[model samples]
Target: MSANASANSFQALVRLLRYARGYRRRIVAATTCSVINKIFDIAPEILIGVAIDVVVNQEHSFVARIGFTTPQEQIVVLAVLTFFIWAGESIFEYLYKILWRNLAQRLQADMRLDTYEHAQRLDMAYFESKSSGQLVATMNDDVNQLERFLDGGANSLIQVGVTVVAVGAVFFVISPLIALLAFTPIPLIIWGAFFFQRKAGPLYADVREKVGDLASRLSNNLSGIATIKSFTSEAREAERLRSVSEAYVEANRRAIQVSSAFIPVIRMAILAGFLATFTVGGMLALRGDLNVGAYGVLVFLTQRLLWPLTGLAEVIDLFERAMASTRRILDLLAVPVTVKDNEGKPLAEPVRGEVSFDAVSFRYAASGVGVESVSLHVPAGNTLALVGATGSGKSTLMKLLLRFYDPQAGRVCIDGQPIGEVSLASLRQAIGLVSQDVYLFEGSIRDNIAYGRPEASEAEVIEAARTAEAWEFIQALPQGLDTAVGERGVRLSGGQRQRLSLARALLKDPPILVLDEATSAVDNETEAAIQRSLAKIGHGRTVIMIAHRLSTIVHADEIVVIDGGRVAEQGTHAGLLEKGGRYAAQWRVQTGAMEESEALG
Candidate 1:
């Protein structure tokens, strides 16, 4: 790896460690167990050397020097020590495996939850710019990648380190000349692992990106299945899916090619080290310069030390893959939150829904299409309607009031208090919104209605449904309010879903209600029913309506015509028609079209 890339990888590891600081005690315990187990694991090789000395050297053996005089006694003592070593290895192996695997499970779960919650609080603009599938990939696939490494790769690396250090110490003490020749190839193997890492890192990163693109294509196709079928484009969609899947496969193939070449090169390097120790130690023992038993220990320990280095290629592959995923997850957590909720006081109690837009201006960064300097106000209990052509910024005004996007140039106030100065939870709780693009959760009719107030009594849910003129249709279903809504309410008609959305907002019973083309999806009869209900319910609460249907807002206490993000006109319905401006021109066109349809009928 380049020095810079290596530094960044180290930084990522450090950041990850800091993130998992809560599990430090468990990490320490697991690591200690792994080291101790590896020490015991290498003891059997040394025992074989001691057993040979007992059989060949008899009273002159190393064990005899330790006070076991007879060859049979030395052999018996060696057997007992070997048994205890193997048992210790087994016990600590179990302890480390369980500890590492449990830590992996817990850390992954906590990281996913924290990342999801942070994503939820980000501003609407952030979501608009990102795809849902990419977010899902990070939360699920990327997090699982880190978990897999922790499950086994971490233990393998720890043991490899302990093996090299413990075996190298024994080699140098027995015969420094053999140890020097045997360890000569160690630097070359270490360099090769890093060389493969530098080459494979970018390839693995490409593999991860392809996975996200494949996920995005699948998510979009599944959500729009009805459209594809209606157009009879199933074959085309299938081909598109195949293309993305193939790209993912190609990316993985490239990464595998690079990682696969590392092991063969590493195996050759390991052979050089083992041969050096075997030939040199044998020559020394023949010359009587090295003890025979010590020469035997060197031969066995050489293989034990060098063979594990061959597995380094696999361990490095896992490490690089996991570090790629870790960087993605951490990048998501670092996204700046533009709409911060930390610096505001709670909105005052008994929020009287007096709302004002004071010379407000907000333009979307991507499209530069938004409201200009617009100003208006609604009294605490009055009804105000907004009328505009498509893309004229009528909805933008409402978004500003909700603080979905703060105005770039001016202030939005509710109950005479600047909304940006109030806590987001209190500000949003004070207003209820029922938008034209209605969404229903996959659950019962009663659950959707009571979503805004889950603890509401059954009687209250029924009443809210009745007020929205939805109770009759709900009752016609076999399960009444208990009937399932399926995904995004696919089981219900468009009109039925719209009413349920309204019912949900009504149940919240906020002091202010905003309806953005709320009745646009319903039939004429249902629209009339909802209109009548609105008349009854609009008595005391403030209502802000955005409508393309001019007839729906004729009875509003005041009507404002928005043109190019500015207020073109404002007055009561009768007064605006008398003025004969933009509002009058649109009213004439809509009413004339209705009259001609009536005459034809």
Candidate 2:
């Protein structure tokens, strides 16, 4: 891994640990259990030394020095203490396992939920630059990595620390000279860990990026399966996916190559420590300076201390991978939310639904994309149609009204109150939107229609469906309202999906409605049927419709012609046509083409 990436990853882990402050109590309890468990676990080695002393030295053993007085009574006392030591080790093991695992589960759930909620709160501009698959990877795969670490890494780290502290104290007390030799290799092992971490961090981050790319490809392909099949590009897409999958595998292999070298180097260091302790302690025993039993205890404790250091490779590998994911997840959490809730007074229940755009101007960060200074107003219970060529700021106006992205200049108002001064949720709640690009989740038709108002009754859903002219086809389905719509409602026709969206908006029954090219995708016959439904639905509601087909909205109360983000013309449809301006020219061109197509047919 590069130095810059390693530093970034380290910072990410610090942030993640900070976020985990809420789990401090659980972490402390788990760490305490792990330490206590290791302490008791090392007691058996001490017991072995005591047993050796009892057998080899009779009444003059270390037990007698501690005032036991008799070999037989000392043996009985040692046996009882050994039993309790083993039992205590087992008890703490259970406690650590339960605490750590539960902590992992709770932390994973909280991180996933919080990430998703934050993602939803982010502005549309953020989403435009990121893929759905990348977001999903952060919420699911990244979080699962952290959970895996917490599940085992927590206990392993604590135990490693406990082993060092507990065993180092004993070695120092028993024989400081030998302890120096045994502790010499520990610094080298720690150095190896940092080196491995530096090399592996970037590789793991690359692996995460590759996985997100692979997921993005799969998600895009699956969503566009119909297009792929129609174009007969299955082989092409399969090859593309194979390339992405192979990239992911190569990324992981790079990380594995670096991580795989860590254990061997660590083992070499451990072996040096073990052999040093063994030879020095044995020499001390022979010189009568340290008892044979003490030498036995040194051998056992040395193995207990050094062997677990080999497992450090596995724990460090988990830590590095988790920290990589932690960085991505935390970075997402750190993305500054440009749009926030307004601390303004709430709109009264009986809002008039009047909307106004005062000199609004917006330019996307990318080139050749923007809406210039624009102004317009639609009174309550009136319908306004926005007509223009593609890229004429027609749709951008709707986005501004919905507060998806606030205009860089000028103000938007709802019911005479500046939208900037109205709480976002309350302002949005007063408006219902149905866009040209309809999206429906995999669920029954009834459920999709009632998405905004889940508590709405089945009768209310059916009524909305009827008003949207969707009830006839819905009832004709095999299971009526209960029929499952495949993923993204792939099972339904495009027109059917749009109707369902309309039904959803109708169910919401907001005071203001914005339909941005809502009927553009449907055929003329279906469009006429939808228009008939809209006529009745728009009565006494503030409706703003954006349409490329002028014929569908000719009856609208007012028509505003938008060109290059400016209001070129504004009046009733008939009045605009009489003025022979931009609106009249667009209408003539569209109607003339329709007549030509009809003649040709």
Candidate 3:
């Protein structure tokens, strides 16, 4: 397992490069420009050497052999060459910079979208076990960090590689003895880089993990700010967040402390090469074994070769950070989707909403809280209400029917076909869900209602709002349907949010509708209003209602009373009241003229 984990970490960047294969041509073009630019950038030192040769050698200089007889003409020709070289270098620099940065932006955007699409495909239980903030970090923060590296560090790496190779060639051609001394420090510098890489790899991965935890904490605090304010727990929440942020800072500090020491140590090693080139090349020139101009080139080129190694610290740091983030992003992509549609079976054509639970059972992996040995059926175009005290698994049963969590035992089928064998898209499309916890995106009211059907016409949106009994309240808002609803519909009252949630579901116009405690949080008047709306649209669609209020479901075609994850009674409300069982006891208490007793016997 340890070996496998090590292999996985090492392959993170390799996998990213494989992903880049789609844009290989762009990368190649950008990299070619970078290489050509560096070559021209290195030419200035050689130009200086040729200029030195023209001055010292005078008429018999290397320039004279190229047909320039006088020093003045040679100088002019040299200046022209210099102008074009610098221009060519600047041109390629511009091209590479633009190409690389734009490529980063495009790739980052695409990767984020693909990652989110994959996240949506995952089973509901996976999301339950994960935090939204951590997912956001993976999709946003980590991806942004990689884009930053691409914007600058990518060029630094390519140019530095070019400098090393080009400069080393010049050093050797001048004098092997001087070249050997100049080349001595390079191997040590490379070895140090690899050593730093080994140590910093795990530290950076931990840094990424720490930031994810911090993001999760921040997200939790922001979402619950209202609750925190009401409870006056600002100080406590802030301290909790401080503790998480401090941990993140400490993790980064450790990684920074290690990577920080890299530059100074590399500089010490670089001193060896620079001084040796300066001293040895001078001696070779004085001994008449090498020309003064060649010696000048060697001295200048040696610093060019070695000084950039100081920036090796930064490039290595960027590489490590990118690799760490890549692993996280890839790990999310690597997660096997446990729940998926089976091939060869589509939702039966002309889906009629006949949902059945044939002795189905399931339990939460973390809490072991779920329904067990439950069996019920909602026939086409009928209403079935589920009622029980809280935590009685009523909602869990509905989740199972929706295939949010498949039952561990038995089968859940729609229209006599197992849902697992049906295409997930078609099956889910045929069902519309509206729960008590209504979530609205930060957009106009019309957008929220048409979320499931983006192509829904404006008239259709208003019609659905009217059917949901939300049109009157919506018209009172300043912008009507165009009014922006704040995040999670925080700008709207509880009833308004619930009504909009209903409108969203109604707009889907599905054959099956599941209202899981949809009206539980609303006032009596709003609940009545929603009830009237439900009654109107309840026909022509199979409705599964989970409600705490007995009055709402009293007219249901059937009522199922759940107790401890199992059905204790299943009958019409009138029949259950006549039998004087658990449902009857609850009904009596809710309608009692005396002091309230137990809620559900």
Q: After superposition, how far is residue 462 of candidate 3 from its true place, in Å?
A: 2.7
lDDT of 3 by residue, 119-231 (tens): 99888988999999999999999998888888888899999999999988887777889889998999999988777777778888889998899999999999999999999
Q: In candidate 3, which residue pairs clash? A: none
Q: Number of backbone collisions per candidate, in order?
A: 0, 1, 0
Q: Which stretches of candidate 3 lie over 4 Å from their true place?
A: 1-9, 66-69, 342-346, 593-601
Q: Name the lDDT of candidate 1.
A: 0.89
Each prediction's TM-score versus the true structure: 0.97, 0.98, 0.94
What is candidate 2's lDDT per residue for 348-370, written digit by digit as tens? 66888898999999988865566
Candidate 3, residue 539: lDDT: 83
RMSD to native for every prediction? 1.7, 1.4, 2.8
Summarize candidate 1's per-residue lDDT along 394-502 as a digit string, tens digits: 8888888888888999899998899999888898888989899989999999999999899999999999999988999999999999999999999999889988988
Model 1: CA > 4 A from native = 1-5
Which 10 residues in a row give candidate 3 its minimum summed lDDT? 592-601
User: Whole-model lDDT, candidate 3?
Assistant: 0.90
